[model samples]
Target: MNWIYLIMILLATVAGGMIPMLVRNLRPNLPIYMLAFTGAFLFGVTILHLLPEVYHELGHEAGIYVVLGFFVQVALQGLSHGMEHGHTHLPAAEGHHHHVAVFPLLFGLSLHAFMEGIPLGFNYSDASALPSLMLGVMAHKVPEALTLITVMMHAHQPKAKLWRILIIFACVTPVSAILAAQLGQHFELVTKSLAYMVALVVGAFLHISTTIFYESGTKHHELSRKKVVAITFGLLLAFLTLIFE
Candidate 1:
């Protein structure tokens, strides 16, 4: 396993999760724009990098898994309450609080993180796609971690427990990557299905990204100017990665 991927993901998660707790006076709506940027980047990366490679390697069969992965994410949101796509209510702003099930939220996000780590563990047909995948995951994780911590704060969880939950959430992907590498080594068949795994993950990415865009927009599904700019910048960055790579 490349330690760099683990380090990068961990740093991004810790920073994102910590920011909400450390800075008491954050702009309540800031996560919306960040989600917009990350959502657009993930959308672009899925189309530009992941979808094509999966189709090229797995052919039409990849389509089924893609659909499955999309619905799978839909199911996950039932458990996560859309936290994976920045569905969070900041405690600082809301006058009242509701009971948020901490376990279900963590389980859902951890599972999503684990699936995202699969492609990182093995070399697929188009090795170039790996970097873009890593970047997409890292970029998205920031907002995800932020969303999780924000929700926990809204639930009025203890600070100590919050830190522990954040650390555990941060490690899920790296641990999954390490386990995937080991499984592939012991069982050759694990590698043969890399394309399917990639396709499924791409599906999950598609679902999350699109949901972020849909939910982040105005009630009429129109984007504010600031959100438009952030999204444009994200897509532009994703495009640059393709050209430069």
Candidate 2:
């Protein structure tokens, strides 16, 4: 077994997941600019990296999953706001709150995070794909970690509780990667099944990326004119990086 992959992933799990928590704890209320920055990072990864990679590898079936992913998140977000969505709810100055996402909501949330890497993790044919996928996971996970931290801090929850939430979030990716790495090997002999799982995860990413945009918008006044400009620029850059990457 390549213990390096295992070690690198575990290191990333702890490193990537903890940075934002430390930031949030140090400053309980993050500025909107900071949140927007996180959103921009998300746009860069999802649009620039994750989505294009999925489509290139899986094509139209991946497209369908992307759309499905969007709808699923919309529905999930509708159910509630705050840590439940894995993001901090903006204060009264930013948005509203709901209690729909309780303990039971975790399964869907965890599954969403788990399936994030299923496409590139298990379904890719090229060896070069692995490194970029792993980097993208690390880079993008920063915002996800930030999101959960923001959610917990905004709720003014205790540090111990917040750490617990992050620890749980920490496992979703590494565990998924490990499982995908093992399971993906089997599917190499079964391309169709691989394609189907790829489609499912592509859908998940599509949903996730779009949801980030929606949450960024409505949760913080529905994409102000300034933000629209940021998003436009972000999307253009996203496409350009896709070409290069």
Candidate 3:
């Protein structure tokens, strides 16, 4: 296993989590646009690279795991209130202390993070797909980390406690990557296991990317010109990366 993937992912996770702290005064709409771009890029990568790779590696049986992963993500998003897609709805006033249950939210997000790590760790040698997959995962992590921090702040968690929680959340992916590497070593048919895991993560990506695009519009669900441009740019980037990869 190449240790560099672990380091890169860990750094991306930590940087993403810390973004909210650094950009507390950023315009809210900016992050939404960023999320839209990331979502589009991820969606493009899934359709272009991941889906084909999984089907090629594992045959048609991999579709079942993809469907299962999609529903699993649906269930997780329910618990997380759609945080994965930048839906961090909070009360207007920070002074109003609502009893926000943290455990369920953390559990859902952590599970999602762990699942994401498996494919990257297990398939690190695939030069054609790994770059795009890594980029998609890293891009998605930023908005997710930002949303998670926003929610925790809204819940009035202490700064120290919030940092601790964020660190743990950030670590989950790398830890899971290491675990997946270990599991791969144990499996006699490691390629099949990796293919199935990639399919599962691809399903989760499909759910998330679609949700982000669907929600990224006006009340009437009309996309703005700027948003269209951003989405186009994202897709183009993904295509170019795939071509060059």
Candidate 4:
């Protein structure tokens, strides 16, 4: 709820979306590797830190929310086309371009971001977990931003419209966090709500991370060395974060 924390989250969100646009000249594969790293890091943090916290706080009942969150993410991907996990497949819009119906994708991604913001704001006082959760969310946002921008470009969306959507998406997280924080101040059951929300977010993270890992490699174990290194580094960083926590 602190202004500095909110500002940090906002800056991180904007940077994630803008950095990919700024680095257009870089090797395409670099972002892909980064996606792998972020995915692995998210997975590690969820499994190592968030899951334990949620179960410890809420008991076995929390598992139900986790399961629900897993399926909710699966459904969201139907609209987002797995963009959250770095999948950016889009049909070609070469000669005869048409405006793509990007609203569904935007809505899906925004909802996901909003859900993420709730736990972030609600748990801002948890000194041990807050930093890791924020970092994991920020890391996940980068490749997601890259994937989203790429999809819009492929669909021949106007630059102005694309920027509008990106800006809105960037704002959604902090706004949700602020709103959740305000609600928590007024609600008696805020702690219970936050616990459930955290469990849900953990489930969503599990689905996304597993999907990224499953899709990163080719048949016959043909994963790239760079991707392997990225994943390993991501895991190591997450472990260190856990230790600090």
What is the Cα-based lDDT of residue 149 in candidate 1? Answer: 91
lDDT of 4 at 148: 77
Best by lDDT: 1
**Models, CA RMSD each:** 2.3, 5.2, 2.3, 2.5
What are the clashing pairs of model 4? none
Which lDDT value does model 3 have at 14? Answer: 75
Give the per-residue lDDT digits (tens) of candidate 2, residues 41-133: 445656555565567776766777767666665665543343222454433633545333334344555665676555445544444344544
Q: Which regions of candidate 1 are displaced past 4 Å? A: 88-95, 217-221
Clashing pairs in 1: none
Model 3 quality (TM-score): 0.90
Each candidate: what lDDT?
0.85, 0.54, 0.79, 0.77
Q: 51-153 in candidate 4: lDDT tens per residue?
A: 8888887889989999999999999888776788876444546577734568888888888888778777766334657778778888887777777776776
Query: How many angstroms is residue 47 displaced in model 2 relative to the true structure, after the best TM-score fit?
Result: 5.0
For model 3, how does the per-residue alpha-carbon lDDT over 21-130 read when each residue is reduced to its tens digit? Answer: 77768786786788889999999988888888888777899899899889889988867777888764333554677567788888888989988888776664347687
Candidate 2, residue 75: how far the Cα is off, in Å: 3.9
The order of the candidates by lDDT, greatest first, is 1, 3, 4, 2
For model 1, residues 1-245, the per-residue Cα lDDT tens digits are 78897889988998999989999998866888999999999899899988998898888999999999999999988887788898643224445775777898889889999998887887656656777878888999999999889788988899999999999999998888887887888888887776688789889999999888868634566678888898999999889778635
- Alpha-carbon deviation at 234 in model 2, angstroms: 5.2
Poorest 10 consecutive residues by lDDT, candidate 4: 214-223
TM-score of each: 0.93, 0.65, 0.90, 0.89
Better of 2 and 3 by TM-score: 3
TM-score quality measure for candidate 2: 0.65
